[model samples]
Target chain A: DTAVSQTPKYLVTQMGNDKSIKCEQNLGHDTMYWYKQDSKKFLKIMFSYNNKELIINETVPNRFSPKSPDKAHLNLHINSLELGDSAVYFCASSLSGNQETQYFGPGTRLLVL
Target chain B: QQQVKQSPQSLIVQKGGISIINCAYENTAFDYFPWYQQFPGKGPALLIAIRPDVSEKKEGRFTISFNKSAKQFSLHIMDSQPGDSATYFCAANYLGGKLIFGQGTELSVKP
Candidate 1:
């Protein structure tokens, strides 16, 4: 079974359009995270939620928001996407905030034209 | 600033050769170190990890050598094969804190 899964594995949209990516984890973990990997393959953490409560929020723009409906689901919503927003987004989960061994899902590649 | 620094942005090794990738961190609080392997169009998967208390940990053909005093660690792949061609990342985690990853190394093992 897939431990962590993300919807819309590939997303291509025009600039200024809005879109959302859904992530689900079946590992029974309490901590979930959203990360963005740029063209240079540098991964940076965007947000983190533990038990459906937002705990960490990076310096991401307000246009990018992460919503966790429950402990098993976390979704990212992007409004007015720009060219610079084109990158790979990854969703990860761990047993707890201190559990650093995160299991990552197949990344969603988003391209803004 | 990048908390973890990795060497050799890319590497090419012959089959059966040994491939080494190094990483360094300045954060003394980081106690857990892990190496992740990633392929094209796929997410990174944890391969092996080590703690600061140990100087070395070996798993099959992969080994992690750590230097706590230097705050540096490295991953070594023995008898590298074509199937091992992928991007490898080194990450550091503070005990109860988030993980900070290195820039990653693209390793290509030629057959």
Candidate 2:
């Protein structure tokens, strides 16, 4: 079974369109996270939820919002996407601790024209 | 602010040769260090990790050398195979916080 999964493996939208990416994990982990990987392959943590509580919010703009309905699901919604939004979005999960290894999903590739 | 920095943005190695990737962190608060390997179209996976207390940790052909004094660490793969070719990332975190990743290093193993 796939430990972590994300929907819409590929997304292409217009400059002003809005889009959402869904992520789910079956590892029974308590913490879920959203990451953005740019074209340079630089991975950065955008948001993190520990048991449905927001814990880490980086310097990301307000256009990117992350919602976690429960411990197993975390979704990202982008408002009025722009060209700079093109990148690979990844979801990760880990046990509710600091040093736990994070398991990542295949990733959702987003491109804004 | 780019806490972790990795070197040699890309590398190529012959089969059965050794592959090394190095990383340095500016934040001394980082206590946990890990190396992640990622294949094309796949998410990064943990390959090996080390803590500040230990200077070295080896698992099979993979070894992590950590220099806490210099705030640097490295991953060494022995007898590298073609299948081992992938992008490697080095990360660090303090007190189990959000991980700060380095600019990944793409490793290509040629047969």
Top candidate (lDDT): 1
Report lDDT (Cα) of residue A60, candidate 1.
Answer: 96
For residues B64-87, what per-residue lDDT tens digits would candidate 1 score against the true structure? Answer: 999999889999999999999999
Global CA lDDT of candidate 2, please? 0.92
Estimated TM-score for each candidate? 0.97, 0.97
lDDT accuracy of residue B77 in candidate 2 = 95
Summed over model 2, clashes come to 1
Give candidate 2 misplaced runs (Cα > 4 Å): none
Cα displacement (angstroms), candidate 1, residue A46, comes to: 0.8
lDDT score of residue B68 within candidate 2? 88
TM-score (second chain) of model 2:
0.96
lDDT accuracy of residue B32 in candidate 1: 93
lDDT of 2 by residue, B15-54 (tens): 9999999999888878789899999999999898888999
